[model samples]
Target chain A: MIGRDEVLHVARLARLALAEEEIEPMARELSAVLEHVERIGELDLDGVQPTSHVVASSSKVDVTRALRPDEPRPCLPREVALAQAPAVSDGGFLVPSPQA
Target chain B: MSAEVLALSAAQASAAIGAGELDAGELFSFYRERAEADREAGQEGLNCFTWVAREAPGKAGTRVRETVPHWPDTVRMHESAGSSLAGVPLAVKDLFCTEDAPSQSGSRMLEGYTPPYTASAVARLREAGAPLLAKTNQDEFAMGSSTENSAFGPTLNPWDRTRVPGGSSGGSAAAVAAGLAPWALGTDTGGSIRQPASLCGVVGLKPTYGSVSRYGMIAFASSLDQAGPLTRDVTDAALMLAHMIGRDACDATSLAHPQQIALPSAERLDGVRIGVPAELEPEGSSIEDGVRRCFHRALALAEELGAQVNTDISLPHAPYGLSAYYILAPAEASSNLARFDGVRYGLRAASSSKVEGATDLLDMYTRTRHDGFGREVKRRIMLGTYALSSGYYEAYYGRAQKVRTKIAEDFATAFASVDLIATPTSPGVAFALGEKTADPWSMYLSDYFTVPMSLAGIPAISIPCGLSDEHARAGANGAEANGSGLPVGLQLAGPAFSENKLLDAAHALERAIAFDSTAAHV
Candidate 1:
């Protein structure tokens, strides 16, 4: 069973704030999901390499490098890119100051 | 005649408009009226649309042309002026970025956020002259099987108002099923498209991974995510896909297809060997009796249609697909979603007085995400973070990826002897609203059959095979039941870049089944 400390650690890593009362339930749910997926750990995958993507090119070919030439091109205008920002100042995104 | 116009398939609507039999504006108005009527008349509410474009769509310089310079020159047209899908009114799932409409991705985090640019698929569709109808609802960040995870509200199934329209593309499927629009676009990350299409009785296709560009679609699980068409039938799906595919410099992952894909024109599936995995034999507790009956019925129809059905196939590692997907998808999600901190865009939580000194950036980040994201989103984020964390990475994410390799190898071997593989799109018909919400594991299991295809990065389609009569009998009436009955979907999947073949087989089976359902006016 996953403990409250574990759940809180996960929430912290995920940058989500959990209320004190929500911790027990989150732990229970996460534990259940982990238990369900635990079957993968039991399989014998000796010498098998992990697949990052189904489309990732094989060893003989580096197909990803063949994408369009890396010349400088027109991109999203600064104003348009920043149009959705919740807070912006001096032609840039604004955020709270980092604490000491 | 207006109702007839609204019910026209994407192909029929475009052809009619092009042939001068139907006016584009008139056809758009008919669909808009039906959609508005459906929204207003429902007491429980269909809740299909997040935002409906008030102005009619046409050939125009709508917004960007007025402000941006050199806009027309940068835009590329892959198809000629006379594309088949010209002037078809279509709905887009909120996940895709549309320049004219808000793309909230069914989350409060981006409640009113309109993207600066349209998604590549949306741009291609627009260039082909398909009008934007409305932005449809979905599970917040495409996290849930049912659209119950939508920040606004759940989109009820058109087949039965009391049940769910399977999601995170539920709104798209429900919109098409209810005749609000001829078709809609949906993104699938672990069965978001096919499962909902199965439940709603609409035809949906998830093209091969990287076949369609993911440039402006919101990220869920980066490697596993894909966008596809959810239409009334296979032909419409084929037409929509024709315009929506091609390589884009904006998205490096897009498949290289300088030339347009030519769909197979064969009417018969002669000599086509369809592998039926023994593990998914529709027996035991997980498979519903009605679902099993409909699956076998579909296969039998295929046999009669000249396709050689091979039921002796075994995918030993396929049954473990869902387990691996649950690990890999959430891990990627946790990493992809890290950008939503209360910094660049989206909602920022107002600091509360309860924690007097919690006015720092850390507080803002945590509080914003805590309040903005829905419950299911949070659960997945937590699950993902836990799996990817240092101590548990090898036991969980590492093992999951290894298993994914085994699953992919198994599919490669199966395809060596078989032309395609078949399965029931979902375990059963659409369940009652809120039935599986309480149990997260059960909800995850809903994508059991569909995830294996996503894992293998193959093309798959879900076509309406039949209806669950038992579910129909339990309903109050045919109209209140939404249409004929709850829909059952048959999934046809093929190896990479096999979309044309997959669509051909699905088209043949669709003709043989001839399943029909239409939602009644409330």
Candidate 2:
């Protein structure tokens, strides 16, 4: 079952801005979710390998090989790049502050 | 329009377009206008989209069809996946990056961010002549069962204003259900597409992993996410899926499997075998009464059409599916979501505004992430991070992986007995808005049936079986798709890479229910 503190903590982490009225209802609902998920505890998985994906027939890509080749790609002009910027000063794009 | 034309499956649409009665341009506009109207009606509630594609100047969503990639081996796809449907009006879940549109993934952090290149799936869809009409809404990073977790407001169910559209693909399903788009694209990781489909009363398919490219789909659980279509019917879904499928060099995990479905052939279910689980699916445990009623009716209908149905079968470790899914999905999500640190790609809060022009990198990262992600997403990332942490890794993530192995074994055994295991897509139909929003556990439980398939990476589709009484009240918001009679969706699953039989069985049963039951909503 979901604990109230856990729910509140999760909400705080998620930045949900949930009101006081929502906590208890959420706790109750979350408890149901945990209970349902706990149903998995009923199975005997002593030797079972945990399967994360359905199809398991492929090799992982080499991270080093993923880098784009040195083929010279076209670059947009500096002014063209800054054209869509909402605000620009000096050689940089400026953004508005969220706190204000 | 002839009933045949209106009734045209995706395969049929392409064939008809190829044979030349309907103009490809006209077909795209017909659906686009419908989508435009759905958007207009649903603007305040569904939150179905963040951005609609600007009107394509030359094509009107059709000009690029002549450039569609040739697919000779799959004629049905070439017919449907390649033509008007390719250029058709449809929405993509905003989780995917598009060159021309913003991909918020339901977060404020990435608000207004448009990538330089489109996702691979989007590129393939475009190459096949389908244009991106709109960016459908989704849960943040595809993390939650409901779109309620979106940093953007929740996407309401199209069928009932007061209810939720199931998520993280809720917006896509609701858009198609509300007739906002001819079809829309969505990702399914633990029932993301299918659950919402059941709620909205439309067709939602989660193709087997590797069946479709995940290269462009924004990763939630990298191993589990499979992009599929929310079409009005199974055949259309198959056709569109065909065009978007094939081995992509970009996706290392993609399957080079060759399993092409024959649309309209779903009408033959005689030899089709279905497995009913004994343990994982207890009445009142994971299923509700109405879903069961419709499931029984569907099974009976399939039996009437000569299919074999097995009961009391043991999917022995299947019960552990949910536990395994939670551990694995979050572990993957934690890893996938880490890329959003405030350096690039999305919105950034003021580095200059903090404490009188104090400049530091740490504050920027913390403030951006803290403000950008929503509650469910943040909770999941933390949970995933905890699961994957050094001390907890073996106890949680490792242990969960072992459980996943067992779940897969049980599924393999069950499939050996029969081709598919059938169950209600969602426990109950769409619940009222905010009913389960506060409770993350309940919201997670809503994905019970769907999560297992994602865990096993199997293909499953939710086809409307019947509707509820609430469907009658759906007319208030111009819910044209809410049939006067309630709609129920019958799910069909097949062995990995065996979408042919799955679609075939579903199509056959769809027709047997009535040579007359062939119908489409918005």
What lDDT is reached at residue B324 by model 2?
68
How does each model score on lDDT?
0.82, 0.67
Model 2, B45-139: lDDT tens per residue? Answer: 46677777556425533323222222222212223333444345457999886765787788887788766556666666666766777888888
Tell me how candidate 1 scores on lDDT.
0.82
The alpha-carbon lDDT assigned to residue B464 of candidate 2 equals 80
Q: What is each model's TM-score for chain A? A: 0.83, 0.54
Interface RMSD of each: 3.6, 6.7
Instruction: Name the TM-score of candidate 2.
Output: 0.82
The model with the greatest TM-score is: 1
- State residue B382's C-alpha deviation in candidate 1, in Å: 0.8
lDDT per residue as tens, model 1, B1-522: 866776678888888877989888887777787677655654356889887867676552232332333233223545442355657878999989888688999999998888777887887787677878888989999999999999988998866777889999999999998888879999999999999999999999999888788878999998889999999888888888888876666677776543365543666788999999988832123878888889999999888889999988888998889889999999999998898887777888877212235376787789899988988889889989998998889888888888888888888888988999999999989988899999998888889899988988888999999987767623333344434556899999988878878888888888889877454322
